[model samples]
Target: MQFLAALLLQADGTDLTRPDLTINYIIIGVLLVVAAVLSVIVVRRRMQERDDDWE
Candidate 1:
């Protein structure tokens, strides 16, 4: 994974550790959190709707 990240950074010719990229990192973090919350909600709803006999 580290190698892949380094390769991508080299391809883009930009360092992600720069201060200017902070907003981009923040946006990505927020999107990931939102996706995780949505996924958990969908999974719990689906589980609740299933027949209890399977458990």
Candidate 2:
């Protein structure tokens, strides 16, 4: 029972430490940048296609 309680407490504790948090933030930032770039490319391509349709 005590072991189970201790295990539960440990599991409930925040997993993010200083370095881990920083790395996580960096990964998220990179992903956001990639997504933004991809979206821009897709939008530009779509716009170009629309323009071509008019011609």
Candidate 3:
């Protein structure tokens, strides 16, 4: 399994020079930002609910 993985990686030449690498990075970054925003919204909403329960 390891041998086949290594063979595949070698067949691709260098890692950084791949044209699609930048697009992949951009996609990952956008996903992270969206996740963070959603997380913040959920936490804030939960906090509001908790505060209201204390009234």
lDDT of 3 by residue, 1-55 (tens): 9999999998888763656688888999999999999999999999999999999
The better candidate by TM-score, 2 or 3, is 2
Models 1 onward score TM values of: 0.58, 0.67, 0.66
- The runs of at least 3 residues in candidate 1 whose Cα sits more than 4 Å from the true structure, single-residue gaps closed, are 1-19, 52-55
Of the candidates numbered 1 and 2, which has the greater lDDT value? 2
RMSD of model 1 against the true structure: 10.5
Ranking by lDDT: 3, 2, 1
Best by lDDT: 3
Candidate models: Cα lDDT each: 0.86, 0.89, 0.92
Superposed model 2: Cα runs more than 4 Å off: 4-19
| lDDT, candidate 1, at 53 | 45
Task: Give stretches of model 3 more than 4 Å off.
Answer: 1-19
Model 1 is weakest, by summed lDDT over 10 consecutive residues, at 13-22
Per-residue lDDT over 1-55 for candidate 2, one digit per residue giving the tens place of the 0 to 100 score: 9999888877887763435477888999999999999999999999999999999
Model 3 has an lDDT value of 0.92
